[model samples]
Target: MGPDDPDRPVKLAHAALHRAGEPLAFGGGVLLAPGTVLTCAHVVNQVLDRPDFAQERPGALDLLAVSFPATGRRRLRAALAAWLPARRADGSPAAEGDVEWSGDLALLRLLDDPGPAALPVGTGPCHAGRPAYAWFGSGAPSSIAAVLVQGVTERWIVLDSTGSAQPVVGGYSGSPLWDRAQRRVVGLVVSRSGLRAFAVPAADLRELFEEAGEAVPGPLGVEDGAHGPMDPVARQLLGPLRSVLTTPEALADLAGRFLAELEAEPEPGPEPATGPGDDRAGVDVGANDARADDAAAIDAGAIDAGADGSGADAGFPASAERLVRLATARPHGAPTLLALLAGAARTQEQQSWIATTALRVCPEQFLTAAEHRELLTLLADGTVPDPRRCAAEALPLGPDLEQAHWPEAVAELERYRPRYGRFPQLLRTVEFAAAAAGPGTARGLGAWSEAVAKRLGLAEILLEHRAQARESAERARERGPQRGAPAPVVQVQLWRATGTEHFSYALHAADARGRPLHRSVRDTPVPRSRLLAELGALLEEVTGQVEPGAVPVVEWFVTGEELDLAVDQWVYRPDELFPGVLGQDFLCVMRSPELRRAAFRPEHRYRWQVLRSGRLALVDRQDPVVQQRGAPVPVCGVALCCPAEEVPRLRAIALAVGVPGVLWLRPADHAIPPDRVRELVHGAAPYQLPRLVYEARLTESPDGLHRNLALVWDSPDGHPETLGLGDPRD
Candidate 1:
């Protein structure tokens, strides 16, 4: 699976469609021979925004930008050399609906050196039971499906999936069908029917392939819901803002103010309230002929997509009209802007138009522009804000929501990106970080939330006081505690990797001594599907149990090779989610019983004692193919990554030496340089590795540092478990 393995030409061969010079992909394609690519013609039409059977072919100058996702982002220009529009056997084009097409093939030839080699060049009948592989076209074949050619037609082949992790969705067209039994590709995957894949046979490819080239694929590198349909609430808030900023000046002012507040140096002092009506409010709402004809006349920095540092200078006038044109013109402008400006405002406006607008709009959450700017800078600059102290700790909450809101906000801000722009949820988190960042950092943010709470009669203001009072009273009541009596509350925990890795887990909703605490379990074995369904259903119950302002932490009890199983990467409630992962919300930790018991050993004792602060050693495995016991002496928790065959033994050696924490990649092929991961982890502590790896996995690239990263984190549970612990049941 390494990049040097010429037999597996994954990266430099698989290609995706993009506008010339852009890195974004529109659809998938594969290299046939040097300089040539084959894909479904519909993908080209889709990218070009043309009708499926548009008779016009691409001109010679109309080259498409292509990139091999598995490989580096080395873009190549490709021209359409051959085209066969979606047509019926009669050679007539298919209808404009979502019907299948038998002849929707296309070939694109690179202008320069095609780096990848041609694929297998033969065509024939396929066996019905033989297993094959296919993938989504946008990126590398990280998640592939095993397909079987169930039925064949003169031009179409019906391929059914045996089983696969990812579904064969809309983006999977034009991928290669690698028939495993024949050890060569038999056809091209042209379309899918639910989980079932429909392919075009190789006979047509040989006749159409001509002399060509190769390439490879990887991640689409697109975030989930990056193209949001806009939530009902978001759209509601957006409506008012759109209506007000009709003229070019108002839009320009808002956009300019947004940019200015984003980079403004905070001034120390109180926020003086301004009047509702300004003398300049009556300034012409209509666009005068004084406006510049060309858009380049405006400051480039204000609208730069790269999030550059340069900015607009003073004397640049504002305009809602010009702003509307820019927003209407650009497709990628997030906030998913839809320009609709209003006519003259007969009645004058409010104190601090931005602040007044923030209060009136976004009734769901009082997220403001100032708060967003402060937070965006913090996230962009990579500052992890800590919970504040004092009354400001109590916004003017540093305004005091760090304790109230920062935790949730900090959680959201992890590995923040500027492209998120002004998402409501994103703003909340940014304000959360600001509140906890100390002093007057979060004054404006706190003021906004409080204003909203007061307006809505919300009791959120007294939440912190109530929690603190409860804690003090409890401590006062239990003055002479000797391991205070446990509450009747249930101790719910989900145990993963206790059995076979995939789709298996053990549940414990009991008290300290393994006695039942939560709801009663169905003692009898019902249907297997029902049992798994119950496990999924219980997630809601577990989520409900979490205290307000607190997160749900899923502690996994795993041991032996089970430690290497990737459980964090699992998708939770995917059907309803915006493609969220289990680890994103849950503070997942793998706790091993073996490591807990090993505390009797001095080396184990030493390891945990020092690793309490998350520090650890990264043990490099010198052995190329075999397991070695050459771990460093007296080290605390350590990373001992090795080849897959050597992993089990290396894990055993660490466990034997009493190491309480460990990390490694599993089923890992060195397609990405193994040594490169060290650079990502250079200054990170052992405790930070899990989050680091989780973020890396989100890249969805085969060449990502998170190649099924697994960890053995047997940290202390903040309670004494060592007093007397032993296995009771077999």
Candidate 2:
């Protein structure tokens, strides 16, 4: 899934069989609906007295339970609701010695919600080469970094383990193999042979649902295309990214043109401006009056002028002809064309077409080093909304050669917002794009296998780093501290008995100084159930020792063989955390005690602060309806209507204060209640943050833009005056 995949929340933790002291993981199940699960029937079948026959009859319900990771490892009882037995075509159950059996799928309904959201039943095809994600229940549930479907039969889809780190082991049976491209669970991994795994195709799953008289829901767009699988050459050249390209031949031709141009001479005239909208006025005004020949020539000029204008004399018609043929044959040259277009589009029209075309494709590889830097630059400075949005979307999904960090990505995105402020479809894409760094970290961790060695030496590295930081701070203090000593900063460390697992907190007495003393250590093992109680105790202990004005700062660290092994360092203010108050407004806004508790964990908070904080707070996301593609999702912007005389104060707040999604709404009347202003400012949805602050200016503004946070005066009529700010027509 590109991002915001609904299926992500519903991956069921596989069922386990508890023996003496060890829990034997036997099968996996996927959440099909609220309180309902889909798995393999054989997984939950109990062997009869003869040992040859396995059935769901008698005491089988008591033996099966479903586990949910989101529910703090809670195991809930489940009962078989439906099943298609593993049997021969003759309808006889498979004999004792018969190993290969068809129709192995089963569905179970949970006694209660297992705390995981349900996964919608998919209607898409399980195609070969599509990216798949399989979570297995071995010891603890672990997700495979990469799983690719190798083949698709009528009833089953075959999975190739070459890309994944873990094989489809025993416990993986009944696990859903999710196709990333289609954004659905296409199959259930039912059996495996060495590195190969097989899953019941989505068609069978849909058929099963239908036979049981259940409607497999929509939002699953189309079933797999009827075209037979692409041959090896096609797979090698374009892979799955070909699905997005509208004119693949054109892309290949573009790439070929680049190659041909490289071999030709450069007739460099005054460099043509190739950025978005550079030719907008020229192209849009009276172009209809121009002959068809002139229009074609202009189109030709777009390609030949060549992004920076150096390749203005290169072959154009021949290149265009070649592009069509190549796209028809195979998108083998897609990557080359993408790389070329990243920097070489010569005209506004060309750039727009390329950008729009790119939005449909999701490349598997990262951008080239030059392309990566250029994309970042475009995001930071590109003016036209479409091209800028394309660059924003491209950055995250594309590879990061520099191993670019999320903070840098976030900053660039923030800069891009105002210039091209409103693309709701792109917002979700950007949110996922920003998170590429975190997954990149996880990918890096997979390659490193010296877990024990790294574990042994990590403490020393951490302490040494901390010591050096303190020394740097002490030196800074001697030179002249930026501010006076901050309120008492206490470092609290939480640990488990393993001497290996631990969590630490550096509670700052004050947040205003933006500094912490980093002295002392305390330890505790935080299971979420008792987390609030423990934090309460820890807070009391630290509060008594710290200065009165000190603001507590806490950070968590998990090491050794923890579930999430990544050494993530995320900080949270004590009051801002769950069961506390960051500010009165925040407390009031996020009022649910249960919601606060669920969201208070280190992993969740770290993810939000690092990955998901665009305009929309995805925290309490409800089930989304079918998203209207390309539509601008609304984000409420603050519209302050005030008397013209008091405009200066409003202007000051708008210009001096920078908050992510806020805009000054200028009403023609320029008059509204003060309380209403506050409500508008705080209550608008995330989408309405002003990209460009517009104001009726007094002095010629500093930045060359006409927009400003204006000081508007009230009309004498005591009616709301109209400003073009909220006008539907820009």
Candidate 3:
């Protein structure tokens, strides 16, 4: 085929060959049956030229190496079966003297089937001008299309070479010229001359098979094809379903059609009253007359099997009853078609009908786990009738029921178990509930066996929830968070160093802004509590830092190594020691220099706080002092310059500092001259920043101090939430 035409069907039937001792004897074949192959007779001649074929006759050969031409991954072997040597109609070898070859064919019977796709030989005529596809399994097999020119003889056909872009080459000798419209192989390629090629007609191949006394496979895509006419019993039962499936449609579209069919059919009469202690009054009549009435009811469709297949006197219409019956009967394609219909149902009505029908047919065989889950969902939602009975009967007992809203299912099972008695379904449901309930609950299954023993009257059921409740009560004596006066918010800088054997850390305690309170670096690993004790002692020296009990906020920075240290012995070991110290009151945040430097922009705001003997000092935005010539630029708006690793940090800092419009600088910005910043800040119309800060100027794109700048202040909401993140490096 052409590059775009899908050839998977043809390739599945193609096979290739490799024989011993003949270097130029590469050939191809088509799978004619489960273990049967058809190829050119000349290919067999080339094999006979080798020494390996000298002693072996048909049905006596050891093995012949073969493979799939399309995907030659594994080599397989087939045994020589029979050969129809290239010959004239006069019974002389056609390859000898001046005689021309007519029929050239060879058949092989594989010892082990390689599961190749089988293409039946067509019995119908392959006429001229019809499109034909030739398939081969070469090193690079081609399944290109060609047209049939003419039938040269009964045993040979000529291929139209002008339109056949792909001609018969070395490995194309045994390829089948498949009739695309016919869906069958009509001939096998034998040779090519000038612009034309020749193929052995499938009729002659069939004759050869008959002469060899092998059973001929039937024709394809015809009335006489292999899967024959539908059974009369199945047709009678599935007539309506078959009519719905007669039209070609996708699986998903079948739901609408099936629903339409259901709607068009008449609804069932009202169900007979069924209630506790009333069975004797309505349906039973009298015990002596039961058998005759039941037989009549069955004939009239008054009673049908329930979803559990118990024949439990459930009411259903004649039409629905037959639909379920045929579905269970495997009527023609009913089982497969109904499965597709059930899978495609999207609405509650559709799912309910399909699921209920499948359950009624044979739940154990038909219902999949997902279908069961859907049924359980309906049960939990209080949507279906007699859900408890459905759950106990239709639902499989396992962790499969332990899905969302499982608590409702558990409650249903628990409430109904006693009434269900010793039924296997009910017992299975109880076992499922017990195993599914997770640990540390009063519903612990320690008393399950005891309860069973008590039910059997062998022992008393012991209560197990009391000990668990008492243990929970005793655990209330543990310590709680200290309820003292507020402490000053402390700014802490902790440096962490990783070495060959242990972690060396330095702690720097300070007041909120940058006043140093204490500094110490531990030379050896010490308990975090001991270090906290030493820090508390330093807190007593606290000249200008503390209140009574104000909560402390710590911001820590760690550099040196990344999170991946599985290769090393000395790691952070946070799971053992640091995790406990770092919870709740004591919090540590790690920072990198790249992130900190990127966050340090001049135009943004930074608020400072000071604590002096429990008194507070707070400072708001302070403009940067001019450090350059030619009228130092004022902090008119915010600008963000950060590396890729610090985007989130810069985002938080920009909001924290109350910056105006932001100008994000890339890593490439550092390589640019310092003079470039002047151009970026003041090169454009100088008053643009002032106009944006005060008058709220609008432009096509955001107009800022530089063409490349991002205008955060111009955001439609004028909030940090709308300041969309952008990568400036690109």
Q: Quote each prediction's TM-score.
A: 0.28, 0.29, 0.29
lDDT of 3 by residue, 1-730 (tens): 3545455545666766666433333666777655677777676655545431222234443435666655444566666666666655545555434224655666776666574334433222344555666754453543454655454444567876576776555566787777665455666787766566788765356656566455544322122211233222222223223223332233114423433332222233333455644422133324354333332332234433334434333322222333333333321223334555544545544434333333222212332223333334433433222323224223222122232354455444433321112222323343323332334221433344334323222232122222322322233223221211123223332333333333344555655323456566555655544545565455445524544433343433333232112111112223555432321323222222322232232222221000000111111222232211112233323333334355334434443333333333223322433233333445322113322222111122232222222233221111111111221111
Pull out the clashing pairs in model 3: 1-143, 1-144, 486-549, 486-550, 487-549, 487-550
Between candidates 2 and 3, which one is better according to TM-score?
2
Per-residue lDDT value at 144 in model 1 = 72
Residue ranges of candidate 3 with Cα displaced over 4 Å: 1-5, 21-25, 50-63, 97-99, 115-125, 135-139, 142-147, 212-730
**TM accuracy, model 3:** 0.29
Question: Candidate 2 at 262: error in angstroms?
Answer: 44
lDDT of 3: 0.40
Give candidate 2's root-mean-square deviation (CA, Å). 26.0
Clashes of each: 31, 38, 6
Better structure of 2 and 3 per lDDT = 3
Worst 10 contiguous positions by lDDT, candidate 3? 608-617
